[model samples]
Target: MSDYSSAFTHCETGNLYSLKSLIDHVDAQRLGEIKDKHRASLLHYAARHGQTDILQYLIEHKKMDANLKSENGATAAHDASVCDRLEALEYLFHQTELKSNVRDERGDSPLHLAAWYGSYPSLKFMLEDQRADAHIRSYDGSFPLHYASSHGHSECVKLLLKVAPDTVNGQTIAGLTPLYLACHMNHLEVIKILISRGANIRLKDEDGLNCLHAACRNATTEVVGWLLEKQNANVNDCDYSNYTPLHYAASSQHESLITYLLNRGARIQAASNGNTPLHVAAEYGRNGSCALLIEAGCSPLDQNVQHLKPSDLAQQNGFTDLSNELKLRERSLIHKALPGSNITSVTSVNDSVTQHPKTSVVRLVVRKKNVKRADVSLQVSENEIVNEIRQQSSTPSVENDTNRRRTRPFAQELQAKVLEHEANSRREPNNSDINQNFNSSHDSSQLLHSLNSINQRNQAGKTRAKLPHDVYGPWMKNLDPDTFKEQLNTVHAGLRKVRRNSLVQQEKYNSDDVHVSSAENEYTLVDTSNSENNDNTPVIEESIRGKEFLNNQNKLTSKTESFQSKSGQNTINSGPKHNQFTGDKTNITMPQWQKELIERKKGIKA
Candidate 1:
């Protein structure tokens, strides 16, 4: 049995003498019993290896089953088509009763196998001579065209499309159209051929992703550029997760792709996890990408859903160097904005300038100074205060320049007064001198208080009003709770009133008696005679239908008259307006113009 099966392998290589000797040794009755583990007979091998003479000898002379199927339900014809055995296929079609359209377990016909393998000759023969079904869908709902396009078989694709152009947009079970598969496989030529044949570029797969998304996934620059530039694909197109091409490019760490998408206006801020392109770069430890994104104006302070900034994410992911660099960049930008605001830098005693980390930040420090209790407090003179006030008021009224210059002198005068008081206290340190200084200081203190009061009032008038209790400022111990409570209560009351009214209306409507008309179930019968036939039958007037019916009648008449004049017909064909209808049927002939208008209204409704 093993020798007989081995002889079939020889038959696949077109060795006729070995195949005949093995058959004779095995006896002709046992010849048909020769099969591999997959149950494929000698005919399957012969067709697969393009052994035309061996195939004919097995089927015609040895009486082999030409239509014998393999474990996958593939016939010798399918193998012949896949292996490009055109001569064997022709022999099978002409000499045997084999079915060409038989599908394997995958539901693919011989045509699909030929197209998948890019066997141009087999595919052409099957399509032109055998007339094999080109539109047969596989188990995955993929047509023969999908296989050819996805595998980059340009010739097979062109031939299949030429046979059946309508299958260009045929989708697989995964919702992958031929164009999308081509892009996924990076078959640039197949993509062009499919698109040229009217394949829909905007078709989204089951994942809600387009061809551009597939191209971006594979980082195929040519496919992506063609889709964007030639196909007019949306640069900012998103997937099911709202991820744009820039997100994919960033994740792939392709600098060129990232730059290409960014330059073409791919949004860098589109985030799936609240992380921008910059965050993705940092999370993946893509240092080059991080720098590129930062230079492209991606916000550094963008926080992910976890409230972690890009730098924090980098540090958490073990990219400490990148994290530190990002922190330094942020600090540098802040420092440049404000030259130096209450900040000072100090180097460590043991640290050298070259060895110092540029990431070190300058901090502000405040130290309290010890003050001596003088026997007398310093006071500004009344004449000096008055002179300073007069000079400030007499300063030029040009603008802020004059106001700034005028205020500078007052500050200088105050400094001078303090210095003079310190000198006097040092020069004379006697009890008698202390008493005299105390009295003079008392007079100066009063004048200084008056000048300071004047300055506060002037400054307050020119400054913008501050909030009552600013959160960004130092703690102020005074706040009125009653005023805040009053405003909050007013807003709450207004909201409550609106909500109550809505609830009340809802309750009223729910409790009210609602009437439903049964007009469709009843018929209106009118009597055309002046005399009543039956006393039991109540007479209903036309006015019961009210102003709406009258308006409609007037509109109909006017339209009919206008249409008549337009068609050069003076006579009116509106049959009759019956006052009462006696039967179930109301016969009123509407004009052509009326019918046309009604049709136009119907079309608008549809």
Candidate 2:
């Protein structure tokens, strides 16, 4: 047995006669019992080092178990495959009965090892001759396809998928499919092969991230383009947290990728946790990415869920230069748009910081302009004035109350002056004759629409003037009776037409023209309950049925309520509340024994 250890040296060096001589001296029963530090026998070493003759001698004459597993469950075939020993692998397959599918300690079969180690010759031999299971999953639930695809062995992946096409979409324990692993490793060729073989590109991993998301995170620009152009991937597709690939690209500081996605219509404002790609860039100190995003019109004042702007994020994360740059860009945009418009001079950030101690935190300074009411041109279009008013009125706060009150009297004075000017212009006989001479029905309609729009704008301003502390009430208190009557009639007619059209479309059953039934075209209400609505017919049917059921239930309840109201006038002093339908409410107050007897009697009524 002591001399048998010397046979391993001979076996390792491929000294056939020296190994044979040494093995012959040992006892025949003890010949196969040899192992090294890794618990691998001489046969394992022979297979690993491509000593085919030694393998033949040990397995044939010494009668060693060719399928004997090492401490890691690796058979001689696994060792041969891992070491790329083509001759030893073939000899083991043809001359011995070694199980090629035997798993090692990591649960990797010989085929898995062959694919992982890039043993092209050994892998082909095992797949072609040994008939290895290409779809066998390792302990981590990774198939041989995963191993081949992960290692960028395109030919090995093709061979595996050729034998087992189903493994192309096989997932690992982490729910990563072969395509995901290929994209994760940036193996474009492997990914292309997998896609051509029907790999699902849209498959998301356990993290709800797709291959494009992975590619962007790993900065694989070519893979990103392939997925976008070839696969028609949704550029704006969001993960579970509503994070687009642009967010990942920006956070990872992939500036070129961010530009590419933005050109392809990736939403620059798409956010997760209210943090845009710009916010993510600022938070992660991606200054270059921040510059690109800012140049693309991303607003610096947009706040996250925490109500912190991107500049605030940069400031909090110790990026003072970036925060200052963002503030400069914001101020530059504002000043460029409003040059010489009585706005405050856009002060340099350094000056502001030195002049005002409060500017240390980069507080937003909203300076009021000194433009007088007379500065507003009367030639401004009505729509422009209305839009300006809406912009001013939309944000209502207690701090702006005094400013709003001051502007209100100025607005009324301007309106009165405009009316006086219009009245004086109308008194001129030349202007009156010109208006009457050139006005067509179209011109008259246009003038009426403008007047109506002005009236509506006035009403909206009045509504917005309500104080927050004031109690809300009916807004139509000052409405004219005739005008209110006309509006009510118009609303009633519209509802009646809707009900009539709903009934006609359902009962007529004109399949050729479901929407337009040789009568009139109008907007139809859609039913939300009909999940399988292929066309307008099912929707119409479901909507009509739902409305009719509601109507009948309402009528029944109204009738019951009317009866209860009338009967309650006489029964105000009755013993108990009465049932609306049966007039029997005292049964609830019946004694327990009497109730049981009554129930038994009712049950015996056969």
Candidate 2 per-residue lDDT, tens place, 1-606, comes to 455677678878999988876667655457556677777888888998999888887888877778787888888889898999999988987887767787888999888998998888888888887787786888899988888888899988888888899887788877899898888788999999999999998889887888888888775678899999999999988888788888888888678888898898888754557788889898888989998887787767565656667766777777778877877876775555444445465556566542343333433322225545333222233234445555565555776687667666755655665465456534423422433323332344555555555556566654334334225436445669997788777876675554444333333322212121111322233223334555632333213443453354343222223323454542222212222222222111112232345446546763
Model 2 score (lDDT):
0.69
Worst 10 residues of 1 by lDDT: 509-518
The CA lDDT at 474 in model 1 is 38
Clashes of each: 1, 1
Candidate 2, pairs of clashing residues: 72-105
Assess each prediction's global lDDT (C-alpha) against the native: 0.69, 0.69
TM-score of 2: 0.51
